[model samples]
Each structure stands twice: as structure tokens, then as C-alpha cells.
Target: MKKLLVIGLLTLFITPFAHAQFGVKGGLNVAELTGRDGESASYKAFYHVGVFYQAHLLGPLSIQPEVQYSLQGGNLKSAFTNYDSQLHYLTVPILAKLTVGPVFVEGGPQFGVLLNADQSGNMQVGLAEDGTPAYGNVSRPATGSFKRGDFSLVGGAGLKLASNFSLGARLVAGLNDINDVQNLSGINDPRLQNRVYQVYAAFQFGGGK
Candidate 1:
């Protein structure tokens, strides 16, 4: 029943795009977490692959919607300890695009559904409180109940390299918090939200022109 509902919704949403050009896109993702109270972290390398439809609505104006599987997460080094957190998401991004000659610019909102979350590190022992240990023991392969849904804003530009191939880059920033209680220990630590930079190439199905 759930599968049927999703298929129905996708069909409805993609009907308009069916009349336009379709393509496959894959990209590299540099992701990290940011918020008001999270630990210091570094960007982790990930990737996204998906299909998109570009429907031209007017002169030099079009609407593009994409469905992709994205891997997003970060690594943390706090208090001489290291942690790695990784997340998998199914994302849908809708963009309003403007094209001139061989260049195009687009911006829109991206919605994501979390498929998986994982953490590996020496962080289970918790952080120091007043220079004292907080957790009692070290746990391996720690788990957290993170949020399932994510919302973000994305803006990007692309250059046509040929009749059928294009290169692009995009910036994606989270609009909502993606934190869990299990990851927080004190009142001073901040939350976690996603920030990613993407670089990709697209291959059009019908000559990509």
C-alpha cells in the first residue's frame, strides 16, 4: 500500500516532466554538520546519483526536478577523540532554472528522507564535564535516533560542455536542525545541521541537446 502510494505520487508529479528532456546525474558531495551547539567537525566525502527531468516552460526558463540517493555526514575531533557519523538519504530537489546560450543557473528547495544513520568512534565515553569524564564506558558502533526528514535550500550553475554533457556545481544548506538527544551531553554543546557542496556531471538521454 505504501509503495503504491509513492508510485502514484511520483507518477502525478512527473507527468509534466515526461514531455521534456531527461538525464542522469552523479556527483561528489563534501558534507559536514553545523548548528548552534555541535562539536567541531570536518567535511566528509560522499556522493549522490539520480535522475532529473528538465521541462522548459518559457523562453530561457525551465523547471527541473530530481530524485537522488545522497550520502551525507561528517567527522568530529573533540577533546582528543575522533568520531565518524554517516547518513544516507533519498532526496528530491526542485529547481527553477534560467538558461542563456550554454549556461544555466538554478535554485530551489531539497527534501530528504533518511534511509540510514551510523556512527563509529571513541565518542561513546562522552565528553569531559568540568575536566571530568561524563560517560561510564566506551561503546562501539554507537547509535542515535536522528530525524527522518530534512529540508534544505540549493543553488547552482551549469555549463554545457557539449551537445549531450554538462558540468555543474551546487551548494546545499540545511534549514532545520538534524540533531538527536543521544549525541548531546551538555548545555553548552550545539546541534547539528547539514552543509554540503556538490560537483557533478549530467548525461542526457535524448542527445542532451
Candidate 2:
């Protein structure tokens, strides 16, 4: 299975370079966390930057594979505290695109390797000696709090505004639980999965229809 997986990845990377349009992409990400039982975390804003190679397959069909750096997470708010979880990932998305005139729609699977994670905020730690509650600013490494691998599905549409530039929007839904820590000091949630919406611009180096 490992050998097959490596071979597949190699094919996806190598097949596009022969006759493909290379581009750079950057985007705004609105990310959140969702639970298995319908609970949700507050939305947090983040960003992603990447490069892609789009290989024309058929008349109006193309395959695009991208490598990107993405920051994704969610916010948890209480009466006295606001905790934000920041997750950094190296992500790859393999997409199949269909173009109709100036509009195009794409959908595919995305795999992410977690680079690191951290949480920052002011939250309640414990009670003070005088029978009063105490709060402190917390900033610490949280890489152990999440799973190392993230698998997701992405779908979106865009317009070919010009030959070299395009605008697009996409939705990403996590397929696995990312939370590795069950109960933490500030927040305790069930089955954390990523939910993100992205709006981006793609700049293709060699322009074409």
C-alpha cells in the first residue's frame, strides 16, 4: 500500500509538468471547528498561499494539483475569555476542473500534514487564594493537541476573468477528527473537525483559454 501510494503521488506530480499552466494562488480562509454532535466553534479568519499546475486533459477538462501553506483554526469564547486555536499545515489538493465558457467548477480531495499548532488567549486557570477566580494570559505550544494528518474534500467555482488571472471561492470540509487532546484548561469540545471557506485569486504564468 505504501509503495502504491508513493507511485500515485509521483504520477500526479509528474504528469502535469509536460503540458501545463503554472500559477501562484493566495487566498483568505474563514475557518471553524465542528463537532460530531452538531456543536460548532466560532469562525476565525486565516490565509493560504500556494502554487499549482493545471494540465489540460480534454476539450474543457483539466487536472490541477496544488501545494500550499494554510493556517486554519477556530475560536472559543466564554464569558471571560476568548481562546483561538491556530493550526498550520502543508496541504496538497488534487482537483478536476470543468470549464464552460468563462466559468469553471472544481472539486477534489485535499491532504494536509500538520506543521504545528498553538493556542493564545486569556482564560481562567484556577481560583485564587482569596476564593476568587483567577485568569491569565496563555500562550503555549499546542502541536500535541491535534492529529498530524488532515483529510478533506473541497468544492468550488470560479470565473476566468482574463487569461492569466482568475477569481474563485471554495468550501473545505474535514473528513477526520483533528483533535488529539480531549479536555484542556480553557476549552473542552467533542470531535473537532475543520470547516473552511476560501476566496482566492490565481495568476497563471502562461495565459490561455
Candidate 3:
């Protein structure tokens, strides 16, 4: 993880040094985690802020790479309780951008490292007077840290406004499972999956040169 961060930082610094342009971007994200049963957990609104450098490689193509810290997660409401599962990620996406007149299309893979996970809701440990821990259902534990294959796929599109700016949205989808099974027989429920989807709008700075 440290090596990856170092390489990403170096790339960001070197790219701008080569092209001499830098920009700041901030956007909103609609994020959700999907389970294996084909039912989405829930959708939550998150935020993203980052910096990027665009390096021109050819006439119509350029490499736009960014490093962003993003908040992502989902919420679940059942009859017993409601809980929200949130996570923080450091993501790096390197996109190949194409431009034609005033419109542009970009898509690429994103590498993300899990920073943290949080859960907030009615957590019931034991019974008060009537029932066992039945009525008060606590949210399941989120292992938080991901294993070796925590990277995800990211792709999206946007439109250019002026010569120096653009507005666009992208989707980030995780490719790995989020749970680690210690005891197979203890947990028979199969609605566990770690795939996440995020929709975000990006604001580009500096002219595309």
C-alpha cells in the first residue's frame, strides 16, 4: 500500500511537471453496495475531492490521472432496526480521455485502498425484559480491511464546458468480496457481497492542452 501510494504521488508530480497544468476537483457521489441475491443493500450519498494532472500524449488523446479520497457505503432498514455501513477509500484512477469538439469520453480502471468502515444504528446486545437478543438486532460486523484483491473497475462519461473545464460523472464498481468466512456452518446466510457502485461528477481545471 505504501509503495502504491508513493508511485501514485510520483506519477502525479511528474505528469504535471511534464505538462505544466494542475487542477482541483470536488463532486458528489451516490454509492451503493450490491449483494449476491441481486438486491441492492441501499444507496447513500457520499463526497469526493481530489487533484489531477492531464498530460497530452497525442492530438485527440490524453492521460488524466487523479488521486481522490472518497466516502462510500450503504444503508439497510429492516423491521427490527436500521443501520448504515460506511467506508472510506483512497482511490486512484487513470483515464484515457478522448475529445471531439466540445464533448469528451473517458473510462478506465480504478485502484482503491480501504481506509475505514463504520456502522451506526440501534445495536442490541441482550434483551431488556421481553425477548432475547431477537427484537434488538445488531448490524453484522464489517471486517473493514480488504484482502489482496481490493481493486475495482471504474468508468464514466462527461461533457466539456469551456476550453479549460468540464463536467462529467463516473461509476466505480468493486470487484472483490468483502467478507471473510471463519465458520461456514455458523453463518448460513448467503447475501454477502462486496461490490460497490459510485456515481460521481467531476470538475476539471486547467485547459486541455
Candidate 4:
């Protein structure tokens, strides 16, 4: 992880001499996870802030990458119960941008490292609507930590606003599982997954030749 961070920072510094552009971005996230059975899902709001750099590779094409701090997770509610979880992560996305006239479309892969997670609300063992105790305790023992890497798909669209600036919005969808909970003596079911979606606005500071 440290090595990846170092390489990313180095790329940021060196790219400017090779037709690179830099920018700042902030955005909103609507996060939810897919589940099995007839269970429904809920959404939670998250936020992100980041810096990015891009290098022009050819006419109408460029390689754009970013480093960001993002918040993601969701709230769960079912009939008589409510539970919420929040997660923080360091995320890196590498994208290919395609332009036509004033409009551009981009898509790429993103990597995330979980920084923290917090949970709250009604959390205990009881008879669920299905006549089973879905969860076994108010607080289960924390198992292994969140893994160091999460994969996601990212894509978006925007327009060039000025000679050296542009604005855009993007959606990030998680493609990797993030559950780390282990066996809880046959009472706890690992039903929740850590998948999320985010929308963001970006402001570019430089342009290519």
C-alpha cells in the first residue's frame, strides 16, 4: 500500500513535464449493497474530496488518475430494526478520457483501501421476521480488518469550460466484496456487503497542448 502511494505521488510530480493537467474535485455518494433473498436495500450519503492529474496521449484521448479520500457505506432498516455502518477509504482511480467537441466521456478502474468503519443502532439477537435470529448479539467480536484493496468501476461525463478548466461528474461502483466477519457460533449471518456508488464534480486546472 505504501509503495502504491509512493508511485502515485511520483507520477503526479513527473507528469507535469509531459503534458499533464491537475485538478481538484468534490462530490456526493449514494451507497448501497446487493443482497440475496427478497431483502431490500437502503441508501446512505457519503462525500469525497481529491486531487487528480491527467496526461494527454493523443488527440481526443487522455489518461486521467486521481487520489481521493472518500466516505462510503449504508443504513439498514427492516420493519422493527435499524442499523447503520460508515466507512472511510483512500481511493485511487485511473481513467481513460475520450473527447468530442466540447464533451468528454471517461471510464476506468478504481482501487480503495479501507481506513475505518463504525456501526450503531439496534443490534441484538432476536426473532427476525423469518422466525430466526438474524444476528446473534448487540456487538459481535471484530474479526479481521477490512482488506487492503477494493476494486471498482468508474465512469462519467462532462464539458470543457475554459482554456484550462473543465467540470464533470462521475459514478463509482464497487466490484469487490468487503465483508470480513467470521463465524459467530452459527448465530450471525454475513449478509451485508460493502459496495457503494458515488457521484462527483471535478475542476481541472491545466490543459494539454
lDDT of 2 by residue, 102-161 (tens): 899999999999999989987666778985668788998889989999999999999999
Which stretches of model 3 miss by more than 4 angstroms? 1-20, 36-40, 77-81, 123-149, 181-207
- Clash count for candidate 3 is 0
The digit string of per-residue lDDT tens for model 4 on 1-209 reads 99999999998777644777788888887886545223356888888899998787777788888899988777666554466667788999999989888799999999888777776666545456976556532533222434557788888898876665666777777766576655332323354455555556666675533
Task: Please name the candidate that would achieve the greatest lDDT relative to the true structure.
Answer: 2
TM-score of each: 0.81, 0.81, 0.71, 0.74
* C-alpha lDDT (0 to 100) for residue 18 of candidate 3: 66
Q: For residue 182, what is the lDDT in candidate 4? A: 53
Q: Which 10-residue window of candidate 2 scores lowest in summed lDDT?
A: 182-191
Looking at candidate 4, what is the lDDT of residue 147? 51
lDDT of 1 by residue, 169-200 (tens): 99999988777555454432546688999999
Q: After superposing candidate 1 on the true structure, give the runs of residues whose Cα lies further than 4 Å from its correct spot.
A: 1-19, 36-38, 125-143, 187-190
Lowest lDDT 10-residue stretch of candidate 4 = 136-145
